[model samples]
Target: MRRVSIFVLCTAFLALTLSTGCGGGGEEGPPDSGTPYVPPVPDAGPPDAGPKPDAGPLDLAPPVVLSHSPEANATGVPPESFIEVNFSEAMQTSRGTLQIIPGDGLPNNGLLVARPEYWDVTRRTVRFSFPLGLPLRAFLTVNLANFADVAGNVTQGFRTFAFTVSDGVAPSVSSTSPSEGASSVPLSTSEIVINFNQPMDTSVGTLVPGGGLSLGTPSWTGNQALRAPITSTLVNNGLYSVRLENFRNINVKAMDGAPYLGDGKLDFGTGPDTIAPTVREASPVEGATNQQYESTRFVVFTFSEPMDTNLGMAELVDGSTRTPLATSFSGDGFTVTCDAQFKLRPGATLRVELTGFKDRAGNALVTTPFLGSNGALDFTMAPDTVKPYVTQTNVPEGATDVYPVEVFSSAGNPGYRKVFTFRFSEPMDPSVTLVTLHDAQLPSSFRNLAGVWSPDRLTMTLTISPPSSGLPPIEADKLQYLELNRLKDATGNLLDTTIPPLGDGRLNFRTLLNQRELNHACEHAETQGPLLVTATSSVTAGTPRSDVLHGLYELTLPGSGNTFSGYTRAQLITNQTQPIFMNGAPELTVTDPASPQTGIGVTLLPVPPACPSITHEARFGTVASPLNLRFSHGQQRLRIVLEDTY
Candidate 1:
């Protein structure tokens, strides 16, 4: 109506639709495409949002053989050939079936047992190989079935292939009965068996006996063997030869279908058995002395050859008395074991007597009883009844300053322990050597006792351990005794505890000063030193009565005219030396040749103090006691304190 152009009219209509209020909406703007506005129906709340539908089963296919080696019905295959199968698709090498069977419908499982499955690099192919060579000149069938693929697909059908192996090698004798050039063949030998290296044809064969030997009909005994019985009377003692013949016949060919290389032959001689079995060796050999009866295991008697035990008897003889022994023979009758229940007495000889024994050849052994000879065995039972005596001991009776082999405590002082060893004249049974350690003054828990036997079983080592509690180092003056209550030899003989009239297995020892300290203090001093004595100024003697410190001196009493009566005395006290504290009991020898007392010697004893005095009083004179001096009546007694040199 306003005469607007068509394009202008269309553009105005689009602009109006595109502008606000184009669609029938009350509050919201027009639709994006200029169409009627319609919502998505609230999304249907996630499209029904319920359980998912079942997926059902998957589609699978079976695996099939694509190709194989030695293709079906192939011929002239090697006897050791491997049967291979290639699948059409990848296969589960582990999940498959393979079988090797004879072409003929025989159920020969040996072939299947002989072959094991092997897979190629790709795993899609399987191979079967026989470790042992396959049967010769035979048609074999290989079957593969039920192989699976990666997609769970099993082969729909099985596979079968055939192959024939050609024969090549011939069979020959590997060994023979009566052996080649055999002699001394038993006249009673029953049969002769021939063994072939390779299996031979069993259809037909023959045996030709010659050289005055009569062999019975030949018979197949095994796949690769034949045996023939020797006619009893015809098997003479002279030399004879036997042969396997006619094996070259087609029916009698080897398993490889080849003729036998040559006839097998054996030559041997028959003779009567005459050699007797002798005593080849013996255990605890003849003349074995000091043998402990308790330590005696089974005695063995080895024979030169297999013996006949039908009438065998053995006895162990002690002087005129004979004791039967339980005897047993080894498998080959070449060894005999003899056992006895009673133990042999000490310092006694046992003679073994074996009689009525024969060899496999019906020959008898020497029956005479001989001493110190292989013909008769004898062993002297070690004199265990004499009782095991201690040849040496680590700690002797009344020992002093023994270095502690183990931990000990002495007057609150810890001491090193000493290993106590008891060496016996004969081997001892440590198990029965009851060793009890206790304080000499009183029974106290001052010991940690442990013992071991030397490898030779003759020395028993008893060691002390540190006390669990109480004192540590043992005191030097600790009195202890080790009582070996049940000391015994290997034969159970008790120890000679009554020797020297001491208590049974009781050893009394005293611990003294440490040896190292004592040795260091008296390194160069003679164990026994000269005693020196002098008179004090208050005395009538020429010199004051004094004791010398580690000194040698002379003492002279007042003499009327140079005839001096001299006496010497000294005391050494120490807590470090053996027999710890004591005085030197000196002996005096006058050197004056012209004097009446010349060459006179006397040993002086220091009189003990009457009370608790510091020094002892001693008098030297020819009184009731021996003395080197006849003192003048007015001579004074000397009171001297000597220095400890050790």
Candidate 2:
């Protein structure tokens, strides 16, 4: 160990001459030639922790320095470089006691802060690189007695590291935000925060885009500890550019392997640097239930652009007549009104055309005749269809009877049939029950609910037995008409539309002569086997009338999706009940306009009631002239009509 100490001292003496460069002299014999520093040995008297015994013999010595990176006078170190020293032996990792004081840049000037470039631990060397290699004279001074060795020994020394760049150059400057090849950017980037190598004079920045709408000059303001540039609001839905156009002329260039080492550096040399902001599709195509086609009072038009109202009435269309209804426009307006006489005939179609609406860019539309993909563009109005039907003529088509002597004819001859049926355009509620039987008035309590039939399936039968007692006390045997409004066809649409309605709502009859009532043997209801009876007299008024003298149930075929339009009066015949079902197929007939001579017969409606809505329809004519009654998707009901009445 003594021999190594001597060798170390010899090397230090030589280094002192190499850097100090002092000539042989008297008082300054040699650097580090002064009295050698020594540490005091521990006191042995009672081993007390009192003031370290006054000055025993100097026996303890501090560890000596071995080597350092950037050896003694290395040059061109980066700003982010570190300083490190190797002791004569292994030491502890104590960083707080170690530091490198930079020669340039103010304290905490966002530069030269903890610049630990990299550490070659295997070789015990630390280094930091500069933002850019700089060419300036910088110094690294280390304090004394900071770090200690495993032997509790520290270097009793203060050392300095200084270097100079031979050539006169500075650090390189680059901007990252307003990128070099960028064409469009934020025109109002208020903070132009630029990063520097060592330290920089950050009093240069500008903003404000103007003149031709390019980037404008930015106001340089060091706010919140930053070299910021101020500008106005950014362009809405468009793009603009920004640039470090001008600043105080401060120049800098990079040293080979270090940061630019110079002060007062700003926008040394630079000039200024535009993206188009696009349209996304419109909803509800042009001709949808749009403003023109929705029942005059229910149309609306919405667009993606600031609509121009000058184009006016050409925006929407009425599907039925293809006529133009004036359209009123508003930014947030969703509803509009139309003139009177707004109605669509049932079983009709319409077309909606649009070709003159303009966009915000004033570009006229490119598409026309836009139809609702859902097929709602075609709406039809129901036509007038209230015709009294000859539901059941008990007297057949022709018959007669004589009085007194010869007496009224037999049951068949006298045309004494007592059952009949009929239905109106719409249905009447049984709640408002009405009836007029024979020549007497009967109460509803004695009336039974009539059975209904499907328009799509026209034939039906009532499994009912009417009661019979005797003639009524009032009008006896007149047996004239049956009056009742308590009959409806599913939909609440009523059968009567007039204030007082039309005629007597009854069918006439005729009777034949030459027959007489047989006054044969007689038997009462009890004596007979549940008699489906024929009374000897008409219902007596003021008496307990058992049987319902009158009642009615109806069905129709002339609404939205039915099949009864375009047929001449002759081809239309209202029937008594639903037709027969053959192996599930219905046997039916209607006057098909396509073939008028003989009526058309079929098993199913040309169009069927598809679930909640009607798909197939009744055909009184060719396809174009068929009626369209339907079971609407939302309205869970079927409509009925007296087939030929429309």
Candidate 3:
């Protein structure tokens, strides 16, 4: 093979346990002092022995130690010492037959569980270690029955005799009952357990209570586990411990299923694991009204795990000015309520800690002396709170237009309606738009229509799906109104009430809620004309010619000023395109300027009221778009709605 070059990569962190493939030789034990090798006189022996008897090759295989060491039946060895084995020959390194086993209650002794670094064949030696818990001269027997020599030969000898270690003192224990910092000890507590560095006596039948601690019962969780039933009672949540100095431990056994040496008490802890509390977002909201918080309310907290109820309370602070605050807590966790008066100085925050706390087991916060640095929540408050208002709508007072169709009802009744547009001078949050219909007998709903925005998130273009049906005619007749409130501008200022439904970020106009438009332009239709206005005593009354006829200038919303009274009068005419029904006696409607019937706001003229003493109303009309011969209809006005500004 060509010379090899190895590229270096980062070294691996895990350890190696098993090894593969080994080379070695098989051999017998050292020669006995009396046996000597003798050389044969080849030719002479063959001639003297006559036919040679077809002899096979002489066996020169190395010797392997089948049995030896500790001389079996020996005594007085350290109880802590572990058993070992040796072979006369260097063996193949592996988990193969060369590996050793212990003869005891539990077998497969190389190790109950193999560790990654345990199976290496380094220098033909393998070792394992563990501590013992029993007290007595324990006898241990190791077997060579499963291993083989390097030549793959199964040695016929399987060493089985055993040896004993001297009984030794077990572990020692300091204290047993009353765990550190225990508050109160309970009499209901049962089973007083103690611990020691060494194993102790545990034959229940012996009746010798070691260390004055009672062992009233002898029951193990199983054949290999241990437990003690003491005479004292352990109240719930009481502290206690087991120690050899004042108490006794249940006798522990060895791997060989026998007690070796026993003495001291051992340690065992109990209880459940606990979780830390969590804190979530606080309220009164970042920039909203910051008035009196005396009724401020409780703070809510979320936790990642079940909190240790024993960990105690959390203190609240108006961190802004470092002012101390009184706080209340909910039964669950994390959620706390602070006195509303605890104002967060202008722009400030707070923090919560979960350290210096302990669970029932005295398990401190995972963080040593946990000063609760791992968690916290923050908030900011604002002053200066104001209200909102509406500006003017882009519709004219007493506006009138004509159309070319009898598309509206013509039973000598007045029916009219239209849309009004408004423009704002500044940017606004569409969510603040408050729209409502004023008249009765109408089903109303405000849907946030889809809109386009101007460059920044500032200006919003919103639409309203006007009412189509489910309303009485009265609301549509007299007049429809528009009201608005809570309109907010970009800089977070309220819209000026003096302004129209539209507004600019800075200020608004305080315009009164009074305005009206005349809708009397209802009559016949002519392919080409301004409009027709035949005046009867009223738009709803079937009046005779005797009703003084007049032009479409008399419009008023009762309490609103009679704005059209100063306008010039008009003749009767009509635009056949826009028409309406004679419902609500006489109702009036406005029109969208961008529509085909833009100037057709005046289409039909209504008959005057036969009884002038009665109120006059007007319904609405529909506009149509026409092609060379075919015509497309514009918006249909079936009902009218109105509202006031706040």
lDDT scores in order: 0.57, 0.33, 0.35
Per-residue lDDT tens digits of candidate 2, residues 163-200? 43323333333333443333444534444444433332
Off by over 4 Å in 3: 1-55, 59-164, 168-331, 337-381, 385-493, 496-646
Model 2 C-alpha lDDT versus the unseen true structure: 0.33
* Among all candidates shown, the one with the greatest lDDT: 1
Clashes in each model (backbone N, CA, C under 3 Å)? 29, 76, 109
Alpha-carbon RMSD, each predicted model: 31.2, 26.4, 24.0
Across residues 1-646, which tens digit of lDDT does each residue of candidate 3 receive?
1111111111111112113213555555675698674433333332333223344443335436544444587664455454445556544444323222343333354323323233335323333334652124666654545444444544466556566655654323333443322345444335543322433434421223432334566453432234467675332333344432322233332222112212322322332333322333344432234323223444444332334454444444564334334554456533445443323333344443333434334444342122234443344444323333333343433222211111233364543322234454444565554544333223253223244345533444433332453222213233333444455655466656554333322211212221122222232220112222223322232221211222222222221132211111211222323222232333332333235244333333443321222223332232332210111112121111111111
Pick the winner on lDDT between candidates 1 and 2. Answer: 1
Candidate 1 stretches greater than 4 Å from native:
1-264, 267-272, 290-294, 360-362, 367-374, 385-492, 495-646
Q: After superposition, how far is residue 551 of candidate 3 from its true place, in Å?
A: 41
Task: Give, for candidate 3, the lowest lDDT window spanning 10 residues.
Answer: 1-10
What's the distance in Å from true for residue 359, model 1?
3.3
Angstrom error of the Cα, residue 323, model 2: value is: 2.5
Cα lDDT over the full model 3: 0.35
